[model samples]
Target: MKTFLLRKVHITVCGRFKLNDMHILVNTRLLLPGRFTGVEWFTFETLRRLVKWHPDVKFSFLFDRPYHQDFVFGDNVQPIVAHPQSRHPFLWYLWFEYSVPKVIEATKPDLFLSPDGFLSLKATIPQISVIHDLNFVHQPEGLPWLTGWYYRYFFEKFAEKATRIATVSHYSANDIATTYNFDTNRIDVIGNGVGDDFFPTKEIPDLLELDSKPYFLFVGSLNPRKNILGMLKSFELFKLKYNLPHKLVIVGDPMFKLSEMQSFYSAMQFKSDVIFAGRREGSDLNKLYAHATALWFVSFFEGFGIPIIEAFRAGCPVLTSTTTSMPEVAGNAAILQEPENIEGIARDMYNLATDTLLVDQLKSKGTLRAQYYTWDKAAERLWDCINKSL
Candidate 1:
């Protein structure tokens, strides 16, 4: 691996240097082994395509810890493991502010790409950072004090520091620009995509041990912004109103505010009906989506609702919030409801449970809508953003 040390004269404007000479430094810390979330999937799916499509371009993926070779998509790609696993707010600062700059100084790549939104404030190179959402901005109580403070303090700086911005949706882009007073034109919207693993299944997989009773599904971290309490209240209302045996199956680990989730769960009248299945992914997650009565993802805010598309691809009808990017991603394919309207959510849940025709219609529309977003398109848009930054 040859290292290029020349500063600003690496490429000419009118006739650029050979494409083979281009080198891109990437923040790949989110690509954790066996822990695939929305941001992780976005990073992996788009990067794999970018590396494959541009075989001559060298991409140096910087990881904070030991990386899985599955993330290294091509021979043109180089994986560099940096120090200090950035799990906490303090470590996050050290890794991005100090360690990442050290790597940048050493490599001297033409550009730096940060998919997880964090940026190196010390770097002089043109950088692109993907600001996923302003969840912490809207609802600071949703996160821990230190974590929320870190975001509030540094994210604004990151927005100002980036040469170009990429986000999962237009709602996020607009929010970033408005909140941070940054230029909207500099931001690119790269929507989320569903992998081929998620699809409509004729029969539920044997791994999921559910009874004959149909269930409503909720997929995401058990955080306050997800409106876990609201969903629980809505489920209680639905159970109280109807004599049906429909269950509310929550599939995700308790990421934050676990005590609140526990308190709500303990106080429920139909607590036995709510199943807490911690974190399902890949084909197992697909099985849950395909067999669910409907996906209830009425969150307070979201940059992009990945599960809504996942459910759509799995032939599951959706009932999501009208706020932020949920409506943008869902289009006319889902039943939209206000995040705080527990009655409305319950009513929609009841409607889905009883109305077979409505469910079928949503399933058809959702599958069609899911076709619009794909990793290939996302990768192309991200690559375009990289090119524009350069």
Candidate 2:
């Protein structure tokens, strides 16, 4: 390998470098503070670990808006704010398609890393997009027309243009290759990691009041694709069949029109048993997961189910869908049920709640399974991919 010494002090990779000093640009648009979505969590955690591990590389985080000091870089890292804050949909498209190209040209980054999938078509640098899923293509009716159209149109082009594609699961990679007609050989599978914060908690704090009775948890956006209505229906059936005294706890913000869930939410015969706890962060979320009887996440589709791993880490048994990437991610550690089988889902939930032996077995297996994923491991894989591509 060729190497170069810079400033008579620093050593840099010059030719066919194996993950040595290189200028890297990571898109931080999804990592906005106070808006910590799943993609944001992945981006932030992976970037943080990458910078820490590779001190010689020059890392630039490109953000559309000014970021908090906590997210600011260290010695070899820097933040480059390229565009003004624009939450409007049209402005967002314009910023990415038009304004971002200018920023890329100015930065002259070796590679452009986008965690949110789509990249500027005008960019000259090699691009890597971390596309989580293609739900918009498969379930277009679940999202707004414009949103689905944007994803279907842009993602295909992005996949075609990108030098290398990295996805959270093999299932997603296959879907992307099939849908966009891109070579699957160019796609890299880098699974997501669960943070250390999601482990089992010994003390259930009184502030949460989560232990008054057994309850099932569903911790994700209240979107149609998540199969929230199916889950609700299944829970209602489960209550009737088992006559169990339990509540259904939802812990995410509504991601779509509230009207979609109103009927199911209103039709609950045991309306008082259902609770919308809103969004919980940090220890609150961890505690909630730890105390849950079981986590029910039978979504219609997924690129990768990060919450499945989260529940596993928290020692909470998981009952997830067998569709898409869920089965792959959950393996045999979780109770996999068909997304359409409301009765089956309810049965599994009831079993997990009352079956101590089964619960223990699941917990043990899940903890072992969760050991395979970590942010450090993901960062290492990412760095290797970048180096290989370079």
Candidate 3:
């Protein structure tokens, strides 16, 4: 958001990549400071490495609002704060279609990279879109009507027009390819990653603050597609049948269509046992994962479940959905279950709570699986995608 001027540097040769002459105009609208969601995390973690790795390649980061200096990442990154802040569906259209194009004209980079998948349809330059998933397409009820409509209408066009596409998992890659009928060869599979901070704890933190009770952790927005209702119901069932001391700890702030979840929570007999530790991060969030009984992320759909790997990195066992990208990300490390199977989820919860050997095995597998993903590797793959487009 700082007012810094950039001189347009043109490449004299076109055949091969010249690091000094390359300028990539990135749609960094999702890089909101302090509010790192899945997309924002992806953008921040990867872009941080990208700029550092290719110091000679200029990266023009287009932001709708003023960005934090920390996000500047390196001297190579030029942060340009453009017009109206894009938060709503209408504003999103205005920012991407109108505001971004003007910035594109000014920067005139060789290629454009859109991490959150919103591309400038008006821009003539080669564009690469990282379409994480088609979650909105599969479950429209999870989003606001206008937001859903915008994604359904414009994303296909974005995919078709993009010079290259990048997605998190093979499942998501396949979903994007089949949904848009896009060529698989042009798509790059770049998965989400875990930070070093989320490692296994040497000893469990003091449980006095949490009533000294072991708890199942649920992380992610309390959106309908995340199946907040389903998770609550399953936890209620587990409490009812077992009457155990274990509690269900819910993390993350409530997002979109939570009236039903509220209604269900009111009717539950063991509602008091469920703790809503909203929007936790840093060392506290790391401790929550490390000391939890297991991570219960049974979301109905996902492009890729980031918490699965985060939990894996923290040496926490996982119970996630079998559908979509969960199995692909979890592999054999997590206890996969159908998101709709309330009874089955309850059973798995019981298993994790009681079985010691299973926990140890899952922890070992999760640690091993966690090694496959890292921000460094993800950034490298994304850079490769950018290289291909150029």
TM-score of each: 0.94, 0.92, 0.94
Query: What are the per-model C-alpha RMSD values against the true structure?
Result: 4.8, 6.3, 4.4
Residue-pair clashes per prediction, in order, are 0, 0, 0
lDDT accuracy of residue 365 in candidate 2: 94
Candidate 1 residues 125-223, lDDT tens each? 999999899998998988999999999999999988999999999899999999999998999998889899899887674434367678999999888
Clashing pairs in 1: none
lDDT tens digits by residue: candidate 3, 83-193: 678899888887777777777776679999999998988989999999999999999999999999999999999998899999999999999989899999999999889
Q: After superposing candidate 3, which stretches have Cα over 4 Å from the reference? A: 1-19, 202-209
Which pairs clash (backbone N, Cα, C closer than 3 Å) in model 3?
none
Ranking by lDDT: 1, 3, 2
Give the per-residue lDDT digits (tens) of candidate 2, residues 1-390.
222332222212111212445888787876766678778887888888888887888777776765676775566667766554546567667667666676666556788888888688888888898888999988887778887887888888888889888888889989988888888878888888998789899857333434488888999988888998898899999998999988888889887765757887787887678888887777888887898899999999888988999999999999999899999999989999999999899899889988999999999999999988777777777777687667
Q: Name the lDDT of candidate 2.
A: 0.81
Candidate lDDT (C-alpha), each: 0.88, 0.81, 0.87
Error of 3 at 275 (Å): 0.7
* Candidate 1: stretches off by over 4 Å: 1-19, 207-209
